[model samples]
Target: MARQPTSGHEGEAPQKLRTSRQVYDQIRWDPRLDPAAFVIGYETRESGAEEIGLPRFDPEGDIPWHRIRYIRQGTTTVWDRRSRVDLLEGKRSAPAPSAQCGLDARPVHRSALALIPPREAWAPIEAIRQAHDRHVERWMPHINLLYGFLPEAAFAEARGAIAAALRDVAPFEVTLDDVRRFQHRAGATVWLHPRSEPPGALEALQARLEALFPRCSEQSTVSAGGFTPHLSIAQLRGEDGEDGEALVAEWRRMLPITFQARAIHLLSRRGDEAFAIRHAVPLGEPSPEGGDR
Candidate 1:
């Protein structure tokens, strides 16, 4: 008989079959764009004005309000970021409560102490909400996205440092003086302006926060530079026109509105949900003698 054909495995140096290890062995972690990173920052709440045809998504109900931050982008994020942002606030047929972006009295004291005069603090929360309502009405949900990401440790430190810095300069009394406008990447926005001398308190806080969390720098997607810290009252979805200008002018005439700057809040936006309050850092503690500066 012809020599039995040798089994392919017999004497052949074992042919190395493709292995899972070989496939993933040299994969590199590219840091150019970290789509997997977690984002954290402050954002105002939205007043779900109209229910029209949109599904009712409750910002307060769906998302946690404090110590908030979530994955803004990446396949791994809990929900699709852009999709959630676009969802209308409520359903028209259902008439879900149209909640505005605002802080209730309870949260105000906890977040910022002696910073805003009680009356001053209360008024703007509503004022901002009204302004936001107008914008939303005209633009059908004018959402302003003020977002950034920080490593978890960096976030904790930065938030703490900023809070401490605010407390340090509390005596100066930063005031939110007027409404102003700026062109942002997403669109034009109307924000509250804080007028303070030496800008010392804000500056100090900025420096410290930046030193701790450099990832949110001006160059990053979550930029701190040119970020005039103001609660955004309204956002223009499209280009501003004479009509828009007229509308804004009408709003401007209504202004010269004022509020005391109390504290900076940390906010977060996950997948399809509107932004929620994460944590509120109190600016200063009032002592029996007066207020600690």
Candidate 2:
């Protein structure tokens, strides 16, 4: 089906930048910006132009063997133009790591990106998860964006890049208005449904972060609906006889939970210990020396 050209009206979608040069130009065009100060982008294609202003991007264009397919800003290549070799798959890998782990979660899943609600918000949600969840001990009341994050060595260096990517993103408020669930092999896990005022804002934020670390995508690989921003509060796969559908229905009738998502928590744990926030990078700005973590 041919996609129709939309009438460029008030509610029309913003046009996507065609090339890396154009994207760079747009950023440069802004008067309040300094070019060299910013050295970040989650997309290798973001600077794939043959110099600065190549007329067009040719997928099959003549290329060089060492055409700068990757650039590591913080000792980590945020994006690689070429696909990675997934040994398990015996082929080039998907854009996101799909074979690393499933929804079952890895036993050694150490690092992660999450939106942890304030301590005040924790008490109530904590009570709920504790009563129903079989695997709710180590985690705080939070929503997972991307799990299985960078190693501890790269984490400190990577913080600056994460902060840079989020420099212009203002804090957003989220409402845990309802309850939801994901059915696993043996049972189901109930979770808090998070929604933003404008809608899709949370999803957009997740997408941007995922672009930065495509390999840390264990949560999204098995999710057929793509990245679902959710806070798993209750695990129903154990000896408990709680009904997932019933809990979701009951929570739906209750009052919704609200919190300010002012920052993205960089959580990590070693071995079997509980997860703790190593850093909480603030939205719209780089965090201070100590950080608010």
Per-residue lDDT of 1-293 in model 2, one digit per residue for the tens? 11123436789785331333323333232334333333333223334332211111211122332453432224443223344211112122222323233322221246778888898887768777778765566777778787656655456666777888888888988999877776633445678889986678788888888787765554564344667788877766533354655666776776488888888888887777778898888888855345646
After superposition, the stretches of candidate 2 with alpha carbons farther than 4 Å from their true spots are 1-108, 237-246, 286-292
- Tens-digit per-residue lDDT, 135-233, candidate 1: 322211111212233322233444555565555645345555666776643346666666665566555555455554443333123233444455456
Residue 89 lDDT in candidate 2: 20
lDDT (Cα, 0-100) at 117 in candidate 1 = 33
Model 1 spans with C-alpha error above 4 angstroms: 1-167, 184-187, 198-200, 218-225, 237-240, 269-274, 284-293
Residue 266 local lDDT, model 2: 81
Q: What is the C-alpha RMSD of each candidate to the true structure, in Å?
A: 16.8, 18.9
TM-score of 1: 0.43
Instruction: Give Cα distance to truth, residue 151, candidate 1, Å.
Output: 6.8
What is the model-wide C-alpha lDDT for candidate 1? 0.37
lDDT against the true structure, per candidate, is 0.37, 0.59
Model number with the top lDDT: 2
**Model 2 vs. true fold: TM:** 0.60
**Which number leads on TM-score?**
2
For residue 212, give model 1's deviation from the true position in Å: 2.0
